[model samples]
Target: MWRNTMNDITLPRASNHLKADALDIGLTEFIEEFGDQLLESLNRSNPPVYAGIDNPARQWVLEGLKRQPFPAQAQVVQAIAALLLDQNEQAGIINAEMGTGKTMMAIALAAVMHGAGYRRTMVIAPPHLVYKWRREILETIPDARVWVLNGPDTLVKLLKLRDQLGDTYDGRQEFFILGRVRMRMGFHWRLAFWQRRAGGGRSLAACPDCGRLLQDQEGNLITAEEFQREERRRRCDHCNAALWTLMRPGKSDGGSRRNTVLKSMCRIPTIGPVRAERLLSDFGEDFLASMLLDNVSEFINLMDAKGNFIFSDRQAKRMERAMANIEFGFGEGGYQPTEFIKRYLPDGCFDLLVVDEGHEYKNSGSAQGQAMGVLAAKARKTVLLTGTLMGGYADDLFYLLFRILTRRMIEDGYQPNARGSMAPAAISFMRDHGVLKDIYTERDGSSHKTAKGKKLSVRTVKAPGFGPKGIHRFVLPFTVFLKLKDIGGNVLPGGVH
Candidate 1:
């Protein structure tokens, strides 16, 4: 098994044939007949192509395309906006070569999302690019707000804000820039204090028997069912203390917290109450309100409020501890989009999920891939922008493809973690298929055979070549190969191809 795990299996290459004029005619006729369908699919699916345009800002951006010398950025912005506005099924992959202005395109798309009322936009990127992203936002979106969420110090500020404000009434519409690790870590919080403070938590009642924490129906200090069975409420047969103290909703109350406001203002780095107030004033009340909601929603809902649901405080605190466990500055094992999204974003929050360097997640076993999978599952729509999509193999597309079409993975017989490994079923399926190039194999007997004893040899197709004609063509079965060289480096001293 271990040998099978690491061996490189080579595959036989097949001979190929080509028919040039027929291919040309077929291509021409196909373009003439089904060109619109092809273009539509490209627009809807591929990068550097317009998907659709509906939002007004997107329209303006698209319209701006008509005026530019090249108009690539405007066109991409319009396409991304269109994809988001349409809430279409297909995600996007922008595979523009590096140094081709992907950053500008990403920023333009972000502006379009903001204009369309997207609440929170999490950008996962390398650490060096964090400042660059901020600069791009400032340059392209003059009226837009930005926040760089970096370092433990930043978390301290956010936690302080939560401790003071209780997840409400701070205006903040700022953009948050964080390292990819920080973005994955997201947020989680304990629900115990919330239960204690919120009136909806378990109620305090007297037990006629020996005192213990008991429910209203009064059985043992266990489940509500146990409480219903007992005639007299509360009191453990062993302990004699009052049965309950009325554990409120597992939520914290910053409203009653003295110095809550002071702590909120003081926690912000390099900004005391005076500076926090001044910054708040500069941005205005609405911005601060947006910020508080965005930064600290996990701290809000547990407050004993009207119609609050009880999901078990102990479980919630355990989850919070998990969320708070930071590894290498990223939220490794604790990535939870639902909780963070609920706290910070408005209902139906993100209009689009724009994934940059989408090819990075082509390996479903990767953390980036898993994290993107979560976001893709949550977002209303998703757009993956990457230039190097196929990467010389068909299975290279399978991982990212299945992630976007989440149901497709299941439909294609890809089991979920039945093997106790992160390798997605899609990857395994691709290996079963003929997409990935086989490099090695191992055998126990003298020959490789099926269970029925049928022999088998794995094979791969060799990359074809271009013929004398400018189009891609296959090598002839009978052909001669030759190369010309300056025998003494003097035949063509200043030559060029």
Candidate 2:
């Protein structure tokens, strides 16, 4: 039963291949032989404190958590911390099952690392789970500060954070949650250039720096609306300078404050369209905009003209919590968060990166995956949380490992080529750790002048199954597996999802 279940649950491995001296047993016969006691023992947690990490540090991790972890959960938390701190590993994986409290365990791991001097944690989560991540982070570490960077005002918020925040750690565990979709979403852009006259009163778009005539790659003169439909960054052939900047729609308020003010105000928690309109009418645009932009505290503590509190205490608290991590601006430009992180933020600005739904970033074609790679390089350490790591193909992990454990991958000679594409490297990784089938085909009765061998040809393709060496080298060193069964009867409902 155990052998068959392992084959069904995990990706195909070296053990799945035929072996000369392999012993096989059916599930019914094995169950009859082993009985219930052995199975029961397998479905429970083993209590052993992580080595080298003292009880005092463990207690500190536990003290900071709002909800006490079960023994099995605590074991995983400690193991992951030991991997990062003692083992000097760059990544840790949480392979917990669905509905088995994976989010709680990740939050606990963050808390443990927070005690170990990794104070700032960055989370890349699915779009739908951004608020859920914030909720869990606040629930687990009640004192921790969490920011959600998925809303429309993300660029403005990042701009403010860059200007106001200092390089010093503030002693509290801080979390910044960026939605994976928003991290790679396209931003509006336009070419920045000046007009230069080329005799006969004819003018053409010219480079802002070198005054060279701006043209497309084909050498045609550029028009003012050349980028109206699609905009991209291009460099001058001579000056080699960037010719594009983020599109700034509005520089200042244009007297139509009702729509913008009401829109931003309605984004706050518990503020409906009616209240948004009333607030705009009561306090005016500049006052409300300043409150939302500079001081959310004042808005939360706002009183009516009659000196009465506008909202109940509960509403005030909820708004304050939600508003603390968000920023609203009347005329902010759209900027991709990943681009902002790489270009504006300093390296290692975030201590740890906690990637939820980590397997989603494994796709070779996803822009989100490339953006994740950029962030992984920028962050000091990356911990990926995934229910599944591989999709039966070893190449699925090629780009993932190249992103997170880039040094190790480079040491193994899986680096990208000069063109910056890892497609060739991914093929190499697939051929190495995964199964590759060489298909040879020859025509049955085809006859040509030079076809005595029937035109024999071959093509190699990837097959399902990963090599044991790859798992031993890339997976086992960093991963911390936690099955729901391992979590045991005392921890959960004792049923599979």
State which candidate has the highest lDDT. 2
Off by over 4 Å in 2: 1-56, 163-170, 191-231, 238-242, 245-332, 444-453, 490-497
| Candidate 2: residue 328 lDDT (0-100) | 61
Query: Model 2 over residues 93-189: C-alpha lDDT tens digits?
Result: 7777776677888888888878778877899987657777888888888889888787566787788778856766568788998877778865566
Clashes of each: 43, 0
Supply the global lDDT for candidate 2: 0.77
The C-alpha stretches of model 1 lying farther than 4 A from their native spots are 1-57, 61-70, 154-173, 184-351, 407-424, 427-497
* Index of the highest-TM-score prediction: 2
Q: Can you write out model 1's per-residue Cα lDDT over 315-430, one digit (the tens) per residue? A: 44543343333222211123343345446544334445656676778775766676667667666666666656556554565577777766645665666696655356645655
RMSD of 1: 17.8
Steric clash pairs (candidate 2): none
Instruction: Please provide TM-scores, in order, for all candidate models, with all chains considered together.
Output: 0.45, 0.70
Worst 10 residues of 1 by lDDT: 471-480
